[model samples]
Target chain A: MHEEPLVRWDWIGRNWPNIQVLLEDHVVMSLVPIVVGLLVALPLGLACVRWRWLYQPTVGVMNVVYSLPSLAVFIVLIPVTGLATRTTVMIPLTFYAMAVLIPAVVDGLTAVPDHVRQSAVAMGFTPLRRLLRVELPIAVPVVLAGLRVAAVSSISLVSVGALVGRGGLGYLFIDGWQRQFYTPIIVGIVLVVLLAAVADMLLVLAQRLLTPWSRARGSA
Target chain B: MVAGEGVGVNWLIDFFGDPANWSGPDGIPVRLLEHLQFSALSLLLAVLIALPLGLWIGHTGKGALFAVLSANAARALPTLGLLVLIVLLMGVGTDIPVLIPLVALAVPPILVNTYEGIRGVDPELRDAAYGMGLRGGQVLGRVLVPVALPLILLGLRIAAIQVVSTATVAAYVGLGGLGRFIIDGLATKDFPRTIGGAVLVALLALAVQLGFTFIQRLVVSPGVSERQAVR
Candidate 1:
């Protein structure tokens, strides 16, 4: 077990191209749904703030959606949607992101300091304008933090779709499990972990790049 | 959008209405109850191990670094990959899937909370104890652990919730759990049954979270949260 495969020259020559292609496809499948979910959930989260009654009931429903087991969601979708396609892959993935995103977005927007909102109000900014310029800019980091968590989770989860023939790293893991093989399975596992690390790192980088002030805020 | 028809969602309703689901070659509800039992058993085991160890490491002063790393790694590692590795070694039936993911889901919150509680203990209280010549055991029992109780409880709550959610993945190992209902529902394309399992898992998580929060109100004193920002 201690004797590990360290991506030797020969191994890299043979596997790197395949790995690259596999990873690219995996990233796309994972991200596409995330983007879609954000498009839907973000507006809804904002709408919760605008319409008071919608907050509790809207969040409550999304919470239920969020808490549903990933497998259960996938299985349920199979019958109505049938086996693999973007719909099968995206719908459940969207729900998964929704669970994390909705609350985070709401909390983030709410966390925008009172003074910031006051300044906007004093300046006669409309609710939508205040949200875009002041509220959202401040909340962006916390919102992104939630996205970071969901992004990594969704990427790993896309594999479950593979069991239904979506084709991703999960195929390798499941394949290896049935045959009792370790190499390909380990390869898939390592790749997923690497994918998570890369995704997390990208988020970290974005936090730094997009909010140059965040690093200063952290240290100070 | 479209009303349910393609997967014959009604069979599931019919199945649930009938009592025959309990005697499966893999009986649906029976398998689900068994799955919950498995998750509960493993989560109980994990909380037992993690809580004390977390407390010990957090209070020890020198142990927090390792605890943080362990928690981070536990959170980051993919549960599915971990289960697959375990099934390879153990040749799956029940244990690998149930225990592996349960533990993976748990470690972070437990470890972090324990550390927070320990570190949150008053520095002056520690000096006062030393000035009065208190022993390490007495300090841990009287001062450190109680102060940390709320955070440790919080950690347990988080781990518990994740365990419930992750346990649904156990069916991949051929273990009978609620996951089996989901698997069957998916195979048959029965929306209500599939949705039924999903709703139940969601409810279970919500119920557990609420129960734990209610319990936290009892374990953690008002003073403890004032210092929650310490670590």
Candidate 2:
């Protein structure tokens, strides 16, 4: 048997169109979850914070959800969402994002010191105004930290969706493996890693922009 | 959709209720064992490598930045991609391909948690240990490890759950485990088997989580756990 090269540039050149579509699918599938997860988790996190007892149970459930493998979850959802559909992938990804983000949201909100909260109130700030202008902004750094983790993990996990037929760059892994080729697998791994790094850098930049006062505090 | 949903649930039940799945080389018992074997081996390897490294870095306070960066980087590496890439590179007829990615997946949580746990220990306690004539190794083993026990255990727990869950991917590469049912079923269009396998993996993951909670309770010192709880 002839030894195959680690990467065949010609193969990549021929397959660039398919690869680009998969890449776009991957980005959309991964990013939607983060945006939707934040939308859902904010209120849920607020509820947990408002009712302190709810926090533990919510975290407990989220941890259980988090512990379940993404592949397994994707398969299990096939009944309702059907296979190879974006919804099948996005639904679970959203839950996974929430699992990480909800805790982050709570922790970020709690990180607001008592005096800060009182001062906001002292300055005639309403509860809603205080939360919007004071608390959420203060929570940005911690929330962004969690968002970075969630974002990176989400990007990495999006590939696993390939098993059920929706894995973005993950499809390349399957393609390369079945054909006993290396180009797609190598490309897949590099692109996924690059996506994670880019997502993480963007979140860090967002944190820097949003929380300029906490510039002294170093990276996690 | 409703009718199809009913049939799906029935198939899932029938898949579990059938005694044939309980026996033979392809049985649930065997696959479960394989899953555990892969997970346990990967975790053990990860701990062996990570624990010492984490301990050294934590005790010395050297290379903290490296530890943090590597853990973050490890987290970002797609497990499926890593598994496929390794299998492609190594030409899988051995378990090494599967184990590498699983170990890589398990290492970050353990390494980061252990390092942070040790680093987070009170300096006054370290002073007390040294003032009592304890050497560096003695201080680390007696005072630091015990004090950091809760976080270390937490790290192990996280790693264990992750390994167990991700170990399902072993089946994708022709290795046997609970995931064999999933990957094989999906390939053969066996929805019941796929769902059943998924259920088993989720249960195992939960069991691992609960098992670690029990271990954490048993191993962590009451004083330390209490302090953590208060914090």
Which numbered prediction scores highest in lDDT against the true structure?
2
User: What TM-score, over all chains together, does every model reach?
Assistant: 0.79, 0.97
True contacts kept of each: 0.46, 0.79
DockQ of each: 0.41, 0.75
Tens-digit lDDT track of model 2 for B1-231 = 787678778978989999999999999999999898888899999999999999999999999998898888888888887888887677789888778888888888899999999999999999999999999999999999999988888889889988887788768987789999999999999888999999999999999988988888888889888887621
lDDT of 1 by residue, B73-182 (tens): 66556666667777666656657545766776677778777887788778998778777888988888877887777777767766776777667765666666676666
Model 2: per-residue lDDT, tens digit, A1-220? 8877889999999999999999999999999999999999999999989999999889999988988988889888888888999999999889999999999999999999999999999999999999999999999888888899889989989998999998999999999889988899999989999999999999989988988777767553
Candidate 1 chain A: worst-modelled 10 consecutive residues by lDDT: A3-12
- Residues A70-187 of candidate 1: C-alpha lDDT, one tens digit per residue: 6656655765676676577778888878878877788888888889899999999998898888898888888898888788878888776665666477776676777776765677
